[model samples]
Target chain A: MPPEVEGGETTERVLQILSTSARLFATTGYDGTSMRDIALACGISKSLLYHHFADKDEIFARITLGSTRELVQFVESRLPEGAAPSLRIRAFMAATGEYFQRYRWAWIASTTAFWNDPQQRRQTERMLWRDRYEGLIRRLIEEAIAAGEIRPLDVPLAGRLVLSALNWMHRWHKPDQGMPAPEVAEAYFDMIFHGLKR
Target chain B: MPPEVEGGETTERVLQILSTSARLFATTGYDGTSMRDIALACGISKSLLYHHFADKDEIFARITLGSTRELVQFVESRLPEGAAPSLRIRAFMAATGEYFQRYRWAWIASTTAFWNDPQQRRQTERMLWRDRYEGLIRRLIEEAIAAGEIRPLDVPLAGRLVLSALNWMHRWHKPDQGMPAPEVAEAYFDMIFHGLKR
Candidate 1:
């Protein structure tokens, strides 16, 4: 086989390992899981697992960074170019809810019990990504306010509230239960855009 | 000493242990702590500590249960008697925010790393308390809708969104920086009740 094919095969195996580990970590939690457990779950020898990754922390960092990047990209991709600020806000909220719904394990893994002993690099990566994400939302809110699409308010607080609600969806959203992500997003949008007052 | 006085001293000691352990667990996480650490922090012998509580797990259970009870009581006490639905909603939101602010350690300890290996009883207790809390919120929403104080929507979903925004405050709220708890509560109330649409 050519060198490129060999490299591609190695990349696929690494992806498989990361995906499997993410599921296990999400379900059992980081501390509750071990490298041996991951190896067994992946049906690979310990040495082989080590060859693909340095350790469990490396695998965890990869998954978290990967998930965060994907979430950002997913939201950005869904956002319409040159759309009204209100429409942009709706798209952001809907995409966020849907991303959490689809990548439930990734969200769980990034924010749950494993956060206690995060590597410095992982923590920095998360903070940077979070800042960027929040900055985007804050800008959108500012735009909406300037456009007179929404009332003036605390931009940072407003952004935080919206992000918090969307982030919390992973904790309770079950694909099999209740309304689908789109409907849930619609209800949330209605509530956020229109005051609860009749 | 009189029997009553002796019992009172014992109760004080138990409370001391619980308070100190809650701080430690909150700051360092449960798995990061040990019985020895708790004993040192409490300035007591490990044997004495064990005498009061069977183990760390027991201590954790006691703190969590106590905190949950206090949170329920706090919200209940703040709720005005025979008030309008909107007022009741305000009280609930304010109380929820304040409870998390005051009992920051308890909220941190209960929700963080130790949640993975929870005893069956602890899980059941958490579920029971959560059900009660959510039920209360849902009822308030239903009452608000009936009173035409707010538009009709999915009661459970609305309740979750509100609770999520409140609960996520612990992750980001800084008492010394930015808005205080009451101010934060007011902003949330405004956004939640009045929405963003002008």
Candidate 2:
């Protein structure tokens, strides 16, 4: 009896479960958290937890897949279609910041999930979403290079340079403290887009 | 009983334990790895393990602190004495790449250890080392700005931009797989130093 479109209380409970589970996963690591721990933290019974998820992997998959899907959709929506690749790249950073701020815990948990782990790599669907997200950036870089808007560079490496800054934000960028996420993203983008050299 | 000024076999054994533990910690998260697991994985009796490390935190601190110390020393040695900030920054990246590849597991496990975790923050000594490493970069950036080698920008953010690129290397840059680590670092530095814009 996995969650269905039976909105209202069930939806609320599911969201609660997902968020709580995400925090635990983020702090404790995926292999560290158990369904029993999740249920205890969520104030739900084992039976109820089982009713919602087949097991820990199912819960993990649901949370990670959902987060990735939301991120992809959010970034996609922000891109100015048919615009210059540089503009789209800017949008990508801005959108990442907004999305990260809105769902800090889940976003960090999902993105930081160890895809290289042998067990995790088995999640083929999740890997596909990751590829899609990474591919989008690489494609934009390629387009920019082709159009002569940006200097020719290694597309894959270029994509990594842009993403590494945004992905590592959670390490230092405190939410609701210091500069906002969007501005930090903008600053990083500016540094990357315009050379730091005088 | 903890490891002290012992050399020869004792030191070799200690090195072996630290590396094996780093792999487990990196894959399983700090909270997830137990002393028993480490002992079992190392194929040493739990008593012998305890003789070498009082507890998990001590082992963890040893690994992280040692790695950071090595990293700082390596990077510092590479810095051309009194060189321009730009040249020093390049050395920093190259050193980081080389260090990362040399101690791949321990380097990553040490650097990625969650300092933000409340429990981890109590490791004041570890935090100090981290600050020192980061401070070195910040100071270099500040000097560059003062010397007008680079445009004036947020010093802290500039440091993050530089570090984020290096710190996130373990994610995609495989050791001995494709492009060499130093070259990858050089390429990233080039992108940051020279704007992507044509």
Worst 10 residues of 1 chain B by lDDT: B1-10
Residue pairs in collision within model 1: A195-B194
lDDT of 2 by residue, B59-93 (tens): 78777777777778778889998899988998899
What RMSD does each model have against the real structure? 4.2, 3.7
Q: How many backbone clashes does candidate 1 have?
A: 1
Candidate 2: pairs in clash: none
- Candidate 1 per-residue lDDT over residues A1-198, each given as its tens digit: 011212344476776787788789888877778999999998999999999888899888877766776777778889888999989989998888887777677678887743474688776876787778889889999999999999989899999888888877766778768887766876788788887788
lDDT of each: 0.79, 0.80
Best by lDDT: 2
